[model samples]
Target chain A: MDRSMFVSISYFLTHLGLIFFMYPTDIIASTDEAYWIPITLGIIIHFIFLSIYMKGLSYFPRKNIIMIYLSHGKIIAWIFLLPVAIYLIMIIIITIRSYSEIITIVFLSNTPLWAIMFLLVLVATYLSSRGLDSILRSSLLLAILFLPLTLFVCFVSFQNVDWRYIFPLTTNDFRFITKPSYLMSYFSIGGVFLFIGFIQPLFTYKPKKILYTVLLLVPFWIISVYIPILTFGNSTVPHFYFPFVEAVDSIDINWLMFDRVTVFFLLSLITFIILFLSLILWMFMQIITTCIPKFRPNYLLILISFISFVCCLFIPDWKDVEDLFLINSPFRFFCLLIVPPSLLILGIRSKRKEKLENG
Target chain B: MGNTMIKVFFLLCIVLTSTGCWNNKDINHRLLPAVVGISKNGDKYKLILELPVLESDNMKIQIIKATGKSIADAVDWLSMNMDRGVDLFHVKLIVLDKQFAKQGLTDVMSGLMRSREVAPNAQMAICNEDLDYFFGNVQKSKPPTGDYLLDFFEKDAGWTPNIALTRVWQVYRSLHSSTRDVIIPIIQTGKLTEVEHIGSAVIKNGKMVSQISPNDTLLYNAFDGQGTQGIVEVMDLATVLILSDWKSNKSMIINEKPFMKSQLNLKVTILETKGNPSMDLIKKDLSTLITNRFHRMLTITQKKQADILGLGQTFRTKLPRAKLKNWREKYYPILKLDFQVNVDIQNEGFLKSD
Candidate 1:
């Protein structure tokens, strides 16, 4: 469980790949002509809330989030944990399909979607079954390997930046930005829920090391959002199907050995996304294993994989996938905001009460 | 052991299947279209894909030409003839003939933007003569022609400043905007057979309304600072100061009548002084003289109401709640633009040529 902090942090970063789906170019394009404000606002709000999530982590040290929740009371925790468990599964299912969708559309257009999903799920299930430790080790390996490629794509794209498009960087529609729904979308740090399980172990580490690790992640988030704006301009950026991939695609080093960089980056990024899927799947499995302690985790893994397969088969289209994601997003945010904060307050209060009685 | 063998078989399949890309094309086989020229012949749009054909002798020096379709129904119609696939992934320049540009090019513009193949950053331009001529002759000068043209549009050389490096995506944005305006560089090859970027063409409602020369483009770019570099010849000066960098500011005022003031500041470094102009004394003199000259240039750009600097967008972003409905009608017409050039003779080469 102490080693789970390492897994929790890796799981946290893996789930950060959820930003891929959240970068909805279609929604952004339809609503706003320029994407700079929303992306900038999203990053700033993300930074603020990511810090909050990391802070919340310290309160729960080393145990799985469900363990911490159980301390509150079976009845209240069950009510709360049910929605969180559902949300985690839903994220896993959506992430599974989104990756399949990208690989199918961009690279393997002729390949069957089921085949892609099956291949991805097989890898994820194996990783999840290995338990969190190996998954975290692989994730750290992936992070070390892929970070340079991501940065290289961004740097290469800088040469192609047409600043004229972003110039006169003004929009008269403050009302559009101030909309409650938009701000909600801006604060959608979807994967920070994984951190609830992390706080327990991370608390043992020095505050400075934790802060430094978090600070390192800040630039990655900024660069992730920033490159798309610089490459596609604010207005056109939203039109891209996958704005990040499209952003990388726009980087054409005429002299470079590679011609279509987006394709290369997309293929490489899929591995990271698979790791992302594995994190969510791991969390879902953890909930099941904890709730039904007598059931073997291997049998549970098969059941989860089967359920995910069925979900992928029926989700039907991007529109349906999007609808499910949208419907689930607010509910998921509700789970993230309410569950951990509530547990922290209640658990601490109960602890204080017991201490007083003993005294 | 049976279960272990089955699991091992599945793992092997996953590893083998996901390793190599099935559709990946080698760089050599793929025809990378750097400049896609589309022209309108009657109702049909002729698609000309200028793809690089690497030389058998040297990779650096390559040949480029149109793959197919002298007059295809659409640009995508020409994709059938290519071996691997024609991708505009590196397409930095989209050249339109003057005649094609004169007629509304909304369809071709939309086609380039909508197609996933065409890059969003690929610049849009209008050539004075046949675009084929420009594409053909571009390589004849020195290095590989396609790369040379790409460099020109890339603004690596500080030669063509203010030649609005408007991309296909930018055109889509401008066309969709309420203003219904966009700017594209107007290029004309000189008598010496060298490509000369003359100025920028202003389009209103997808039709060419006015043209601003390269000198005026300098003033426009200085205000916009697309980080574009170009040489601006001060009124009577024999030499031109290469503008390395530029900065601009704009404001909207709500008085009796709404007005916008735009200021463009250019940092001009002396590239060469042709006549015996004292480097020490004339440097100060040139700064004042250029400032006045730049002001005159801005006065013309303002009168023309070329929003290349995106003053309209600035207002839209900064003061989102403000009523900007009639910016073109009321504010832009009466908008005042001021230009100030600060000249510094950074490198005065050995023996100032007189």
Candidate 2:
């Protein structure tokens, strides 16, 4: 119940990896100027869901998110758990596949793509198979080992920021809320919030603590979009699939042994992504075993990893990777729609039941 | 203890495999080009890569030339022919032929960016002489000085205000921005020197529409907020070095006609005064000199409707999204640019004050 520190640090680490890659391009694609509007909107929506989900979990003490939903009925479980399960699988595929593609583009051109993907899948599955205690402990280690490097990279990546592109500061248009790129920005904001509701058995975290951690994430959300825009301006930023990587590639700081800071940025984010993938895999396996209740946890993890590797191999190229992500938006929407409010309603109903017994 | 050992072994296996360095090549096996000379070869593109010879103790130079359908193709052909892979990561200079630039650099720049080989900040320049002679004589007679051109344009090294500094990303930005144009410095092969810094080419929509003198480039650099190392010789009065406190204010008005005013404030140190000129006379002379130079430069740009000074960037905020597309044709030619220069003498040199 008292492991809030690990919860918060892992929260920060997971979201840090989410912002650098596709998030910047999506946000910049969503709006021309004053990107802060869309950014804050996405964060606020995710924040509300997080608070509600945590509050609901507080109602059922000692029960994890899976058992809480699965205890009700098969219909309730399918309605609540299926959306998140599918979303987790979709993200697992995209993150590993695209991350391998970026590594190929940045430094590992000679290495075949599947080789990288296989390596990523192997590491994540291994970590998740060790179960929850190992995941938490390893996350604490990875955070301490990698957080400073990530911060330094983020700070120095701002070197080429030219404020002149900060022009046309007031768009006065909220229609960006409807832009596909804007709505899909939930890909960054809501990535880690779902994991919190599932963490009840291992530890308890107040929604306020998670909210404060999210407050720190606002700067990352803003910088991820602004650094590329300020450096390249609106006209050139869209040409980039990964704007932050190109923006950092343009930085020419000598005295450092690393010539391409893009490589440094890529490698650091890769570690974070792998850690994040492991966390996702753990929760993913948690759901699968809960559904059947007959399969061994290790066999389910092996099955999931094997299927993920096969799906990743089937993803032919970058275009398909993008299409698959866009196609998964419906599942993402369902997860957002069904996960929190159901927990909250059921939690209130259960509380009434307990009150009747006591009175 | 046995379980811990097995875990450690597994950890070792994962780290070793995941780094993707399984087929790692040593640094010496890679050839990093310092300068790439891009020119036209009949209907195809010719790229000349200038790399440092790896085995040479004195750092001798080597050149590889190839022609293909495009820049990346030529680079690929060169790499296939060479013993080592050619990485453009360290390529610091890209020299384009003047005739090639006149054909519009939009395609070449977009190609370079798309390939993702060259770093975005790699400096871009135009060569008036044919690249064969430029890369040939320059690398041959120069005794393989090992990227002397990079030192030549590098800001903290031997850079001057008269040399306009343009990068690949800046040109790409200008090509995409509806209202913006850019100035890429022009150079030629020098008999004694590696290359001569001649003014700069005023590019509108990736084609050179006009050219400005070295002194004009100084003002362009100052106005573009690039650097304040401008050393101007004001007729027979004095030679003033513009120091780092350079400031400017731009105001614009739009209605039937577009009008814009830029006020430049400069701090200077007097290097040499002809006949010990008065303080007022020195300030007046410096002001008039830069004023006339910028006026001449502005006239050429306005006639060609090139926004090399980036004045259109200010107007970008004023115009809506749709109108911005026709900024150069509809607004730039009619826009008026006026300059006001104020000089403050920070140091009077070694001599006493007048």
Candidate 3:
């Protein structure tokens, strides 16, 4: 089987699952009764943004986003690449810290934070070292196996869901969804890490398969976020730090082998997220390799991993990690708003210039 | 190259072993405590664990009770005796015997919430019966002990509406929050020593003050659909009506005072009716009667200040700025309610007089 197909499929599925896996925790803070508005808002905006991403992808078919910038010549590309590099590093740091905190809270209460971060970083480095193609391929395998399991677990979880909390759909306070800029933060956050670099290589697969990949992702997003809201109610869901994991916690499988589903789901979802973070790092390494050709990709992986491991140590707890993600979300949004459109425009202009030269 | 690979493999093995898996909890040896009943035994508290024991190839039930100043220490006492690891992850039902529930459950509840293993959605109950009999009556057709209890709480029965599915998380929130008090399902075994869900115990400030029967439980859940459904009988002079397919919508309104209006909208697929009545007349009369009864029930809820209807939450949302300082004091007592019953009494089935 071709590895490229795996990466292409994985890239789409992982990107879809990763977005849900990243921020669906916001639904947990939606109290038992007050959870509906943000959930509705999340569903609407996810589709809108997904469409925008597809449109953006359409603009530049066979070129990496950075190369589109470089088409403007070395000067503008260098300026744009500087912020892009910083933003990528910041995202890696936050992902490491967040993953570390999850392990500490759920599975490893006794384990040191640095140890958890180290273990994850080690796996991440190995996956990232395999390059973007392998990372994407692995993601595809992981998604193919896990997405169905996730859906199965979700279907099984419907047994315990009390629909009462969801009724009388009303927004208690708009502040939960909007105030402090949470809506913008929630809509266009985290998943854009995939759109960073090596775009030209990604679309090597057939375009026809891309829609199927995106279609496969819609259920993952809806089930992960909306199911929690439906079960917990808007009032109660927002209180949980990790809503999807909390949704698994609500599973009361009477005679199932495993008593608590939280542990099982967390272990599996964390595996997918680790693959995702690794892909981000691998893609970032690919970008750096583009910049400095002499630096071996393996060395870049180790370098990013070391830096991420060290950064995870600095964060005291999950709250600080959340605060960091919330505060730096604007930077991530800037990447979304700027990177694609800028590259598309540059790609268009470069195309026109080439046509004129050919004429 | 083969030698180097072997050396690396050994090194990886060492590292793997060194990084101990904290979550490696053995299921066979682990004593799974399903429902824990904590009650006051004079000054100290009595902690009861319903453990599933395997003896002579047949599963047996074990009740272990320990007295301690706090819940954690009480569990510590059980830990000393148990041969295996005591895990509460499977602990779904927690019943506080009436004496403990009435005096206060603040201390016991806080401890349950503190444990990381305890599930947030664990169904909590309060009972007036002796904790020992309650334990004896917890027999099930299922082999594993907890499976029977799990099905017991989750079963669709006539009195299930009166049983509040209170989780540890909800208990913690209600205990801390000013908006709403906690309501726990009241379980009482019948004369045959079979477990029966009698009603619900309403707790204010961790103390069980009042109880509501199954019919009133349906009335309460009409606003909040958290519990199971069965037949509800509402009769007038002419005919006896069996109300099935019960569903209701609850809304919070903040006018001069924050009041929650609940519309118990049910598609009354009437199972059986005694009187030979026309469907249209039955619908109209039933609608009016339901409107009156539900209106009275709402008044009663308003009078009791049972904000389980989430009137405080409504005010907190719709009128955030004008939200009362204390929902219990300002809004709950003076709140006005409107009840509208749109009973779509469907055509009679087998019971219809042709």
Candidate 4:
């Protein structure tokens, strides 16, 4: 697949999975009334960070962050790249644990949690082992198949929506825009833009294409957050664990074969989440292999999967998963803050150095 | 060879463990209840599970009754007693006795909301008569296909524009929505029909606050935007088949009192008439009749403080959070309503003009 196809599909899976599973809870927890306030702020911050990241990547065409960092010095690069690698691994663990908890609660009440987690990690590991090209290829295929189905589900879910719930578009406290939960939403929405750097080397980097992909994703983010608040009022959104999923469940598609379209919705979302997990795992493997060039990618994947599996087991419950997010927030912000600018500066330096050498 | 053998073993293990369904419950061993009637007896709850059964010749239903301190307990007791486990996944109709609804359905509503098995769109109604008597009558007069109770609320089959179709999630939303209330259709066993639509039980804060007759339910549906293909008879002046759409300006404020002005556009086809009333006169009569009836319904709801039309939700847009919090108590009753009804007579059937 081409870079545009890869970038768009990867971006779609990453953001859509996050929106479906995590964004509703985060948005409801963050703001009181007029969720659009925090959402708009989040989107602005996302675009700012994305433009900088894309500009940095544009400096070094066909070179990933690992390559750029490696040029600085291997030891210094290890210090920088190790944290990024750990962040990717942590994201994989957290996503797997959180989604498994949702699956257990919503779909499979009787099935053991570890079984679901194991199955998810297993599939993600297999896809990741096949390499990034395979992951991107499968994403394109899955997006083609499931994106329309997911959008149609969202469209039909408007049947029972009470638009009045979105009213009182003003809030008493404007400071909610800076709240921790609101900031945390950036992790789900914009934080995934960091992966763009990792995949930059795979194809010629085009800033406009990537910018367009990010722009296209903003409405999806807004819809995923607000639909639940619109369907079940702000007063009620905080009560459910996965309000968006429940909102989809609340839709009554009478003429459709299935009484509840939520199952179809979950299946599509789960596919995206799996692909997202695969992308994360692939990123982690890339970091590891880049650092230790002698290590086999297959062995490194098994090692990463094993470690993630063990880490997933330790997450006893959803609250612990939440605490994990709180603990990881600073690290998430650190990577989100540090990697883009560092890459931008490096990209600039590399370009100047290249001009000097060529001249 | 060893690596291939290990992979084969793992594949076989996965295939063995993951075969069949995720949570496999055999269909033959599960009882799919079509209608569940809940009534309160002191602190305990009486549950009647109506399951449709197929005999050699005709369709019949098996009614199972159980009692417990809570709905869950009753369900567990029923599950234990039946040869086939009771599954409420397919439950289409949830009938609550008048006493149960009056006492407050907060607990039952919360329980149903928490359960994954119960579909959110399952239709809910309030039985005017005792549930025991209703279920007994339903058993005695078993209609063919055995979906007698389900068909009553099924829009495709038995539902009319007059019947208020309140789903479980709608009831839950109403309970949570500060400005909104729900109208559950009140039903009873009829002499001629299997079930009768008596009126609607107006629920405020999860309890039945007031009742509206079926005649008022038509206007209620019209105001709430569900009225289509409904018949409106104005005394003996004219019988008109009416379809209505309404738009309301909820931002109107007059001297610290919230004001709502609604304009209802009614498309009418005059079906029959007692006198040779001109189309203009018939339109005027319908306008008067609907305006009066709507005002009467509004007055009743205001007296009861039940915002069944969700008029408070409209005012919610203008009010800040604090004022919105107190809207139902402070602003709702004092709110003034101005109704403007516009009737457009589409056609008078074969007689093009009267």
Winning model by TM-score: 4
Better of 3 and 4 by TM-score: 4
Per-residue lDDT tens digits of candidate 3, residues A62-130? Answer: 667666667668898887777777767777788778877777777677677776777777777777765
DockQ of 2: 0.55
Candidate 4 lDDT tens digits, A159-219: 7677878777876778766667766676686547777878765665456777788788877
Against the hidden true structure, what lDDT does model 1 obtain? Answer: 0.62
* TM-scores of the candidates, chain A only: 0.85, 0.96, 0.84, 0.94
DockQ of each: 0.18, 0.55, 0.19, 0.57
For model 2, the docking class works out as: medium
What residue runs in model 2 are displaced by over 4 Å at the alpha carbon? Answer: A172-175, B1-16, B19-24, B54-56
All candidates: CA RMSD (Å): 5.3, 2.4, 5.8, 2.1
> What range of 10 consecutive residues in model 3 chain A has the weakest lDDT sum?
A181-190
Per-residue lDDT value at B132 in model 3: 74
Reproduced native contacts, each prediction? 0.15, 0.60, 0.17, 0.56
True contacts kept of 3: 0.17
Every candidate's chain B TM-score: 0.76, 0.93, 0.82, 0.96
What local lDDT score does residue B219 receive in model 4, on the 0 to 100 scale? Answer: 79
**Per-residue CA lDDT of candidate 1, range A53-77, in tens?**
5555445556546776786679876
Write the number of the candidate with greater DockQ, choosing between 2 and 4.
4
Collision count for each candidate, in order: 16, 0, 16, 0
- Give the per-residue lDDT digits (tens) of candidate 2, residues B1-354: 644654675688687786657667678778888899988856799888887774637867777788999887887887788787777878899999998888888899887777778888899999989998887776675467776878888887878888998888889888887767889999998756778988899998889878888888888888878767778887898888888646555646567466787788989998887797898898998888888888888888888988888776777567766676777778878877678888898988788966
